[model samples]
Target: MQTEKVVNYIVHWLKDYATQARVNGFVIGISGGIDSAVTSTLCAKTGLDVLCIEMPIHQAESHVTRAQEHIKQLKEKFDTVSDTRSDLTPVFEAFKNEVFFDGDQATVDMALANTRARLRMTTLYYYAGLYKLLVAGTGNKVEDFGVGFYTKYGDGGVDLSPIADLVKSEVYELGDFLKVPESIMNAAPSDGLFGDARSDEDQIGASYPELEWAMKMDEAGKRAEDFTGREQIAFNIYKRFNTANKHKMIPIPICEIPSNLL
Candidate 1:
């Protein structure tokens, strides 16, 4: 399908969700990343009230600057929240200072990353409640649902995700079609929570082209649930979601029946 048609479809679908939910606007975080930039642009074009929150906690100056540039170019209304790292540092420190090593540096980093996500989510939700707006998620198919790159109930939480079905490459293609600024499309995709320590590709270990192929293959039809191939590297991310099964499903409590029931 043409990118314009798809983009229009997504925007209208999101508007329906907002109307059905009785929301006045949408809030999205712009991390100088393509996914968020594309999402913001779509929301702006769709006539939805979009608030682009640039929360640069531990992020580098360049990332924040590029994020602002993208917001400006998109002609979207936005606000900056600085020193956010100070607000979230205590949460990360507490997790690290815990008695057990259940959370190591890597784990701590993940938690810290999630803390940022949750903080942003919380802020969005707060504004959503205040203005009766919905929180529009910027996650693409590869990151949001495929590899489960987002934290449960943190960045993963959203009232509506317009691009959730579009893979990363497709999202970029759509962005190009929409005339999203080159800086946004050219910027390296990152969460900006790790402060240059990691990138989307670095964390996922496969380019979006490869990831989209795997996803399309998985969706089309597969001989086995485990399909190994050149895409194995990308598929490993699927393994992470599988191994962490609890994260995949809600925690269910076992029922204890009394002897009388027998």
Candidate 2:
């Protein structure tokens, strides 16, 4: 891909879309990950006001440090870039106190993790509305389209996605080009939703390069049986996530009444 050209195109696209929508700027959550770093930098390049928010709910220290470093660099490089940190740990604790817990430990833990994401989403939107800024999403192709690794209505909620079309490797390319903080660029990819340093590979059981290959193979109509050994294992892992998370990728189901019934 033409990296410079793509960057210019996305910058122009963001400026044009925001101008057309009559929004002043963009608001995005900074998670200290490559996708967020790349997307936020692109938004900054647009010369529009880009508010980088660090919303942490029981977040790991490494993630928080990287997020702060990236935000600091962005602000130093771009005049239009500004940042604010919102610590939401209390909010999360309060929420847990109010909600009834059910199911096994795993299920309950998963729900809480998702709750953290939703809280961050809500925080972003609150600022977006208060400042008339569009909520910029940081999802990439692999998470947004291939495996649907994001929580629906949580991190998935956004006014625009600047980097959603780019895959994981492409996002890393953009991050490198954008001169993102070295700590962030070198750090392993993680969601940071679990308040721990569990990498995305740990969660998915496959590296991004492997997952990208699987996504391409799946797109090319290659099934798991077509490969054996490691390839098959990776393919099956990809297939399992892609199948289970299909709901997040597709449009919400709607009930359409018959003409006569209407």
Candidate 3:
């Protein structure tokens, strides 16, 4: 697929979303990864005020540097930049003391990562309110609506997602066409939860290509076919769709009669 076509599609999609939401601008938390870079720039192409927040915790020094490069690129192309960060040490420690008494560092890291994502979402909303913009989600098709690699009530929360239909590899393709800095594009995508934690690939045990293949299978209505050796990858994608159930439907009501539904 041509990258320019993808960019045009995203720009048009964002325009439609903006008109529907009655908002003139968009905000994204740029983690210096290919996905966010692509999303932020595509929104900019629509002439929307795209604001990027660099919400890196302690382990994300490299991403912080990358965020600066992303900011420079955004300034050249977009309307504004909101370089923001919140250290999660205090909040992490407090939660650790209260509930994670004997938990390992990995557990602490997971909790902190989710917390960091939630904080960034809150910050995005704060700016959105001030600027009359919507909090744009940077999640890709493989990450957000597909496999659900985001935290609920955190990165998963958003007013709109410009790149939710593109897979991870497609995101990189678009980023390259947009001339997003090569460093951010080349860096292995990470959530910056732990200082040197395993990334999506390591955590999932399947590369992006493999995951994308499974996603295609599911998309083509082939989910029930037996694929025994690939159970892990299937399980990961399955969990993603399962947990993102909230995004797929309305909140659970106390009682819903069939008559009421009709």
User: Candidates' lDDT values, in order?
Assistant: 0.71, 0.93, 0.74
Q: Pick the candidate with the highest TM-score.
A: 2
Worst 10 residues of 3 by lDDT: 243-252
Instruction: Compute the lDDT of residue 158 as modeled in candidate 2.
Output: 94
RMSD of each: 4.4, 0.7, 3.6
Q: What is the TM-score of candidate 1?
A: 0.80
Q: What is the number of backbone collisions in each predicted candidate, taken in the order shown?
A: 0, 0, 0
lDDT of 3 by residue, 57-97 (tens): 56557777887898887787655544555555566567557
For model 3, which pairs clash? Answer: none
Can you write out model 2's per-residue Cα lDDT over 54-142, one digit (the tens) per residue? 99988899998999998988999999999998999999999999999989998999999999999999999999999999999999999
TM-score of each: 0.80, 0.99, 0.82
Summarize candidate 1's per-residue lDDT along 1-262 as a digit string, tens digits. Answer: 5888998898888778777877766877777888887887787776767777776666777777777787777663333211122244455556557635555689867766777777777777777787677778888877765666777677778887888888888898998998777867877677777777367778767767766776666667643345666566566655555356445344546798999998
